[model samples]
Target: MTVTTRLAAAALLLLSLAGCEGMSRGQQRALSGGAIGAAGGAALGALTGGSALTGALLGGAGGAAIGAITR
Candidate 1:
């Protein structure tokens, strides 16, 4: 992507996070963990030439479970 596209994406992501302020701590953590995990999983899957969707689904589930438990 171009720099402008990346910057716009980042800006939108940050702006979207503002909505989380109304959620509980646990919900926020779970959402954060899921997002992080999905991102990581997609990257890893791409690097390993695996199915990104599967990896993301599994990673997101595990991350959200851990996040909810930890909270």
Candidate 2:
């Protein structure tokens, strides 16, 4: 990836982590899982010439469901 993309991803990860300060464990896990899933989905979609937004939405939903269930 380019330097700008790497930096942006790092900044997003930092911001996501920073937002977890006052959340409960389940909330934190759900948000974390959603973010990670969305990022992964977006990357995969881009590489495959698919819709990133669609991938992210689907991934976020799946992640949230799994996170909630596992907690």
Candidate 3:
């Protein structure tokens, strides 16, 4: 994705997550981890010229698992 597209997506994501105040601790952690992972994965994928969607999926899954397992 282009720089503008990525920035717009990030902004939208942040706005969407702003409503998660009612979620439990674990749920919040998982969501936060997934979002962070997906962003990192997408960046890595883009830098490596791979598939950003696939990277985001895999990363998000891994992150959610880790987050769920934590305190």
For candidate 1, give the lDDT of residue 71: 44
lDDT of each: 0.87, 0.84, 0.88
* TM, every model: 0.79, 0.69, 0.72
**lDDT for residue 3 in candidate 3, whole number 0-100:** 100
RMSD of each: 2.0, 3.7, 4.7
Q: Roughly what TM-score does model 1 have, to 2 decimal places?
A: 0.79
Cand. 2 TM to true fold: 0.69
Candidate 2, residue 30: the lDDT equals 88
**Tens-digit lDDT string for candidate 1 (1-71):** 89999999999999997889899989988988888888888778888999998889888888887777794
Candidate 2 accuracy as lDDT: 0.84
Best by TM-score: 1
Q: Pick the candidate with the highest lDDT.
A: 3
Ranking by TM-score: 1, 3, 2
Q: In model 1, where do residues sit more than 4 Å from their true spots?
A: 1-7
Question: For model 1, which pairs clash?
Answer: none
Ranking by lDDT: 3, 1, 2
RMSD of 2: 3.7
